[model samples]
Target: MSRKFKKVVEYTFLILLACIFIFPLIWMVASSMKPEANIPVDMGSIQSLLPSIVPSEWFQTYQELFSRFDVFQYIFNSVTYAIVVTLGSIVVNAMAGYAFSKFDFIGKKVLFGLLIALLIVPAETLIITQFTVAHDLGILNTRLAVILPMIANMFFIYLFRNFFKAIPDEIIESVKLDGANYWTIFWKIILPMSKPAIATVGTLSFILSWNDYLWPLMVLTDSEKFPLQVAITNINTTPPVYTNQVMAILTISTIPLIIVYIVAQKYLLQGLGGSGTGIK
Candidate 1:
């Protein structure tokens, strides 16, 4: 085949793959705009997937949603929790990664190995223990309870460690010769250079924390404290089954995370690719 024909084929294949990933999101946005009376009855029809732009049913749905529930409060709670968790995870996980990469200490290998092993363990298995610890500390039903357990994730630590390990030893040694302590090096040199890794971890951490339903549901009893994800669930299970309102809320809940990923996607991809290579 000619080179031009091969390029056309490759582009076609890529577009198809992109469509496969994108169609569901499109469907979701479409569904969110539908009226309760128009849903289920109209589902799977082309009309169901095509949102009415002139009247904009989605806006009406959102208006009803906000009127009924404090949706803004849920959004605020989600943003606050996600940001705190992301920032705290960056500090804690990055520090642990840096220590594992640069420091020589007792049981270092064993500790890192344990951390690696933890990556294979199911997070669901730890819920009871995490709840117990939170209860013991008198933090249950508080924002801290929701935030604390998620701060030190193993995958992020591994990402930072591998990324840090890839930095030249000569650079660290030069900084050390310049009377720099580990903190100085970390704050001034390491973190700034690790932006891609930071972005990767931050984006993932934000998404996980933002979308977390079960933990927040378990810990936060007050409706006022409910994050968007849990709040949306409450909407779903409530009486009369306002499917349109549920869809609208879900659509709103997803927008911020999508915006975040779009903004940081470049760094996220670079960080993951770099970490994968570094680990080998």
Candidate 2:
């Protein structure tokens, strides 16, 4: 085959793959704009990917959702919690990573080894222990219960450590010679250069916190404190379940995550590709 034909085939294959992955999102947004009765009728056909032509039903599900349910409160709670945890995790994990990469403290090797070991342990196994600790701290049913447990992740620490390791030692030494302390070097010098890593961690952290459902459900009994994911379940289980409303809520919940990924796409790619140097 000619080179031009091969290129054409490759592009065609890639477009098909992209469409396969994006179909669900299109269907969801389309369904959300449709009436409940129209959803099932359009399913399994190309029409499923298109919104209702009726102007009245276009936003009917959203209107009902806002009027009957405190969806804004749930969205607010989730966004607040995700932001707090994402920012906190980035700072704490970055600092820990800096220490591990630059400092020569005792037991640093052992501690870092333990941190790496933790990556193999399934997070589900720790839920019971986390619950116990949260109960002991008397933070159950509170925002703190959710935020605190997720703010210091081992994988993010490891990612930051590897990213920091890629920085030259001469940079640290030169900064120190100019009377800059570790904090100055870290905040002003290191962090500014580590945008890719920061974006990677922040994006992942935000998504994790936003999608988290079980822990919030277990800890928070009050509907008022529930996050969007848990609140969606409540909407589903409530009597007179409306499929359109459920689709609308899911569509709403997914938008933030899509926006985050789009904004961070460049940095996320760089960070995942170049952040590591064999875990030294």
Candidate 3:
């Protein structure tokens, strides 16, 4: 085949793959717009996509969601958890990463190895232990129960360590010559240069905190204190599972994440690229 033909074929394949990935989201938005009775009944056919055929309940689903749940409170809870966890993760992970990268301590390698080993252990394995600990601490059913366990993410630590490791030793040495401490160097120099990694970790942390359901469900029994995802699920499981309402909840819940990714896309890409390439 000609070069142009080969390029066209490659582009076609990629578009098809993208469509496969994106179809569920499209279907979700479409279902949210559909009438409540028609959602599940609509078959696996393109007829659902026809704007004319699917009666647009543009505001009805949203209205129902608002009336049924304390949407703003749930959103506030989600935002509060996400922000707190993200900020805490950044500090803990960055400091740990910086130590691993720059400091020459006994067992540094061993400790890092242990951290890497933790990646293989599924989070589900620790849920029971975590719950017991929370109960012992008298923090269960509080927001602290949700935030405490997730504050130190291994992946973010690895990312920050790698990024910091790439920084020249000369930078630290020069700062030390000015009688600056490690903390000063980190605060003044290292952090300013680590925005990409910060953004990457912050975005991931926010998403994890925001979408979390099971752990929060296990801990928080009060509807007033539930995060958005848990609240949405609770609202979803009423006498009748209103399909449109569920879809609407999903769509609305997804919007903030989408906006965050769009805003942080550039930094995320930079962070991943830098981490992969060893942070030139």
Q: How many backbone clashes does candidate 2 have?
A: 0
Residue-level lDDT for 124 in candidate 2 = 78
In model 2, residue pairs whose N, Cα or C atoms come closer than 3 Å (at least 3 residues apart or on different chains), thus clashing, are: none
Clashes (backbone N, CA, C under 3 Å), per candidate, total: 0, 0, 0
Q: What are the TM-scores, per candidate, against the unseen true structure?
A: 0.84, 0.86, 0.83
Instruction: Report the Cα lDDT for candidate 1.
Output: 0.85
Give lDDT tens digits, candidate 2, residues 1-280. Answer: 6999999999999999999999988988898898889988988888889999887889988998888899999999999999999999899999999998889999998988888898777777688998999999999999999899888888788889889999999998998999999999999999998988888898878877998888999999999999999999999999889888988999989899889878877656554532234431
lDDT per residue (tens digit) for residues 1-280 in model 1: 6999999999999999997998777777776776777777767777777665547565787898899999999999999999999999999999999999999999998998888898888778788998888889999899998999889988888889999999998999999999999999999999999988888898878877887878999999999999998998899998866877887888999899779878987766654532333322
Candidate 3 displacement at residue 69 in angstroms: 1.0
Candidate 3's TM-score: 0.83
Scanning candidate 1 in windows of ten residues, the lowest lDDT window is 271-280
Clashing residue pairs in candidate 1 are none
* Worst lDDT 10-window in candidate 2: 271-280
lDDT-wise, the better of 2 and 3 is 2
Better of 1 and 2 by TM-score: 2
